[model samples]
Target: MRTGGGSMTTPVHNSPRTLVLSTKTWERELAAELVRLGHSPAKSRYVANKLLKRIVGRAGWQRQAFLVD
Candidate 1:
């Protein structure tokens, strides 16, 4: 799917448990959630961007596995 910064390709093995989100969308949502939890906007964005950068081009399973590690 087309995201703000780039496109995210869903893997072929799409299952109901597999949720794929674009980097931009994840960053925005993460930042928003952080802000809602009382973090500063700048801090929230910084944290979200840093976290999202690691999985920028990763597929859903790879991203999840990476995070789990």
Candidate 2:
């Protein structure tokens, strides 16, 4: 039950993508948003990270908040 790194490394590289695609709600929402913004659905995860960073920056969430949250 670790959050990241250390002994929690994913054994299969495909696991992360599989997990994301398996989340129906998230995958659908991301695809819809990407279409709305004229970007490819393939870029959803990267775009999501960028958007989250922007939100945290604007809201002044500290570095620990960014990393731990």
The residue-by-residue lDDT of candidate 1 on 5-69, one tens digit each, is 43543433545435456555667778988999999997899898777765554543433322210
Regions of model 1 farther than 4 Å from truth:
1-14, 54-69
Native-referenced Cα lDDT, model 1: 0.59
- Best candidate according to lDDT: 1
Using Cα atoms with residue i matched to residue i, what is each candidate's TM-score against the true structure?
A: 0.49, 0.35
Clashing residue pairs for model 1? none
Model 1 Cα shift for residue 22 (angstroms): 0.7
The numbered model that scores best in TM-score is 1
> Candidate 2: global Cα-lDDT?
0.47
Model 1: per-residue Cα lDDT at residue 41: 91
After superposing candidate 2 on the true structure, give the runs of residues whose Cα lies further than 4 Å from its correct spot. Answer: 1-31, 62-69
Q: How does each model score on lDDT?
A: 0.59, 0.47
